[model samples]
Target: MGIILEINGFKYFAPLSSFKPKHKRLCETIDFIKVGIYAVINLNNMFPAPLNLCKAVQIENIKNEHYRNLVRAKYRIIKQKTEQIVNNAKDVYNHKMINDGKSKLSQRCNDFRNLELKCKEYSDKKK
Candidate 1:
């Protein structure tokens, strides 16, 4: 999972999704980032994932060579665009906040503001 630039001081995580047949039909936008033909980083799915709840992946421990290599390659690509990805995520958040499901992307996106409240509540309860 990769993080969005901190929103309200809370980090949000979004996942790289496998390229669907439908993805090929659509164009990449602020909420959708295409990673060549391998995968797409769907900013619409981003949500507040607390740092403590996230564990580091042991890429070296992967038993499948092909899968491991694919992950590594994807990581390198994503790593190179860390700044862009962070900015895109922040943009997605702001877009959703303002759109409030008015836009098609916002309808699919997790309620970022609401998720932040839930994240804070969960953290407070745990503490």
Candidate 2:
């Protein structure tokens, strides 16, 4: 005799008999697909996102050595997708920062020139 449970609306049909190998295999497959999709979609690193999204990401971390290599293969694909997103974000942020810095510098230079001009006018008046 065994029991089943559900967490956060996700169903878990646990049966007795030591959980047959076939059942384990199926679960592994489900985990791989779910996690891969979540990781790739939320590439911004919004992991552990909403319950539904979490369920998907958690699938990638499923620890089952029996299918370790297979899971790793799927994970590699998701990793590449997420990494690309992260790189793109970094590039955008760097570009914006550079532009903002240039703008500030230009403004400062203009202000300095105006001050210099005003000083020259004062000197001319004194002369």
Candidate 3:
């Protein structure tokens, strides 16, 4: 036969056949009293508190091992893309600076401004 305990919506079972040698000897000597005590201890140890504590430890280990690398890679990609956009905007600004005609310089400046605004919008949306 087995004893069952319900805790935190979970059920734990300890079969009489599965007791430790000490518990088995106690069961042989004291019978149901010692068997009941051992079953209570085993069921309490298998309850939600210790199980959730173990799960919390596992989650922390996973965060330390995997999440840091994922975050770094994500930020590195964003930075590279932002740098590319900035370089393009700079090239447009330099072209505008070099031009002598007001009309052409104004057009290049507008292009640079539009590019910068678009990059900002994109980054904002991404965030």
Task: Output the number of the TM-score-best candidate.
Answer: 1
TM-score of each: 0.87, 0.22, 0.21
Off by over 4 Å in 3: 1-78, 100-108, 111-127
Model 2 scores a C-alpha lDDT of 0.34
lDDT of 3 by residue, 74-100 (tens): 334434544443343344345544552
Candidate with more favorable, higher TM-score: 2 or 3 = 2
Per-residue error for 121 in candidate 2, Å, reads 48
Mind giving the per-residue lDDT tens digits that candidate 1 earns over 23-57?
Answer: 99899788888776778888888888788887777
How big is the positional error of residue 99 in model 1, measured in Å on the Cα after superposition? 2.5
Worst 10 residues of 3 by lDDT: 40-49
Q: Show pairs that collide, candidate 2.
A: none
Q: Which stretches of candidate 1 lie over 4 Å from their true place?
A: 1-5
The alpha-carbon deviation from the true structure for residue 61 of candidate 3, after best TM-score superposition, in angstroms, is 27
lDDT score, candidate 1: 0.81
Best by lDDT: 1
lDDT of 3 at 1: 31
